[model samples]
Target: MLTQLNHIRARRADLRRDIDVVHSFEAWEESCVPSYCHPNWLAAYVSWIRLFRAAELARTIVPAPARILDFGSSVGELGHLVSEGGAGYDFVESDQHSADYLVSRLPGARRVTLEDAPEGGYDQLFAIDSLEHNENYAELLEVLAGKLAPGGVLILSGPTENRLYRLGRRIAGFDGHYHETTIYAIEAVAERLLARRAVRQVLPVAPLFRISAWARKS
Candidate 1:
């Protein structure tokens, strides 16, 4: 148990270092305003940390060199970390401006639209913070799951059904426009996924503000 705990700590340290490297990139700096809408570096930093942790959790299920698809990859922030382990990363972004920006930021990663996504199926699929934004989340999840390879893993991260996150956002003065709508309960989503038998393993990630689910395809 101690060894496992130490390993988790080491992994977190590595993720932090990776996020630091991402912050140092010229493209990351250039895309800040368009991505976050303002120059709130602290908020952006926290976002990166959350994304990094999500990616790390995904890595535990889907190892390196696997094909990865990031749905609604705004500016490809999480894609950067997921792609680092020699994975074939492809991202879908509906917003043309954000898609175009990602082209320069994520050089090798493929920038695709929902329609243009490859049919071959991906070994790992990420929908970090994207599910909450969609009203037709159930349909979207089904569509995404259909595109996953057999035994592939799906990683989802979003704000929990807690008011504290909203309060914190207000206190931090972060942009609230995108978060105006209600977010679905993370546990409800997980239960739905389990009921469908689409995923064999549905593991929940920690950190109360945001919750991550690692679901291995059945």
Candidate 2:
């Protein structure tokens, strides 16, 4: 686990350099900066890679030209990537700043909240790194599952049971703010979904830090 964490940190360093080159410092600061910069910017950079991976994996399941809902979308970065593949997306974010940013960045995407999310179903739903933030994640999962079209897929990913990772974050002074609201165990939630037959498969997204479960609603 330590080795894996080190690998992630190294990769994050590389990505940070790439981001610097691709985006002006001011632009990157505005859109990509994290609240805490202590112990480096690992948390922020790692999130960017994770969201990108989640979006890529989601595309494999839903493909292009499908309707998608990005629940708890922070700045809608993943939704923007998925939309590039010709998918229409509705973004649900509780943060008004993030929602406004999404609207500006993704003009075609609809911005809404969970309560106001469009009725009916979507071809694909993404909750990357957002589930852990919800104290009532299980209930939200059930609600999200109900929003999927027949054979539609829900791509969910978040950190799970990584004591070492948590410790590192704590040492880095990020514990106070990072994942403070995460309460659900990924395994338990996955089991509940499986028992209900709401999810046909629960696949881990390589590296034990995060799990991406592909739940298909029948």
Candidate 3:
């Protein structure tokens, strides 16, 4: 774990030399992935571990030889992990700076627009900390579900927005103003289009964030 954190810190330093990696949530609302490399342990831990935890769950549920799409993938960190896991990777990043950074780092990983994401192409679709930022998250869920191949999984990770989550956000130096909704609301609509398969909490105690996997309903 220490080795991984060291690697991420080094990578963050290297990336910041040429591009902007958002340190605080206020700087760039769209791309806060860089906060994973933050010096503050609490902030960095909360930011990065969700991806690791989500990826852990994904590996357990998603079959091998997978094609993965990372929705709202900021700077391709999740794409990096997916590629390392031997999956073919694609991503959607609307922020130009983050997209440019993603391209530079993972040139082999294709970048596709959400609308252009091929139907029934991906075995695993990841929407990590991305969906709740949009007001149209419910509609977005429908589109994401459509992109999955038969029996494929959609992995979602988002803030719980409960009091504990709120306190953690404040402690991590992030204001929760950017989010348009909570994970519960997103999951409420997701239930209509997909069936929940697995769920895990970010922390052992408080449900600060949820990492869940779902499959399209028959």
RMSD of 3: 2.3
User: TM-score, each model?
Assistant: 0.68, 0.68, 0.90
Model 2 residue runs over 4 Å out of place are 1-44, 85-87, 176-184, 194-208
**100-189 per-residue lDDT for model 3 (tens digits):** 878888877888998888998998899999999999999899999899898788999998999988887777667767799999898888
Off by over 4 Å in 3: 19-27, 85-87
Model 3 backbone overlap count: 0
- lDDT tens digits, residues 142-189, model 2? 777767776566777665536655775566444434352442374466
Number of backbone-clashing residue pairs for each candidate, in the order shown: 0, 0, 0
Candidate 1 residue spans exceeding 4 A from truth? 1-42, 85-87, 175-177, 180-187, 194-208
10 residues in a row with least lDDT, candidate 2: 195-204
Q: How many backbone clashes does candidate 2 have?
A: 0
Q: Pick the candidate with the highest lDDT.
A: 3
Shift of residue 214 alpha carbon in model 2, Å: 2.3
lDDT string, candidate 1, 1-218, tens digits: 37534543454454344444345443333232322422455454455556656666666666663788988886676666777632488988776665775666567888766666765478778887776666677777767766677666677666653566667566655444454233345436555663222221112332334534445434
Clashing residue pairs in candidate 1 are: none
Better model by lDDT, 2 or 3? 3
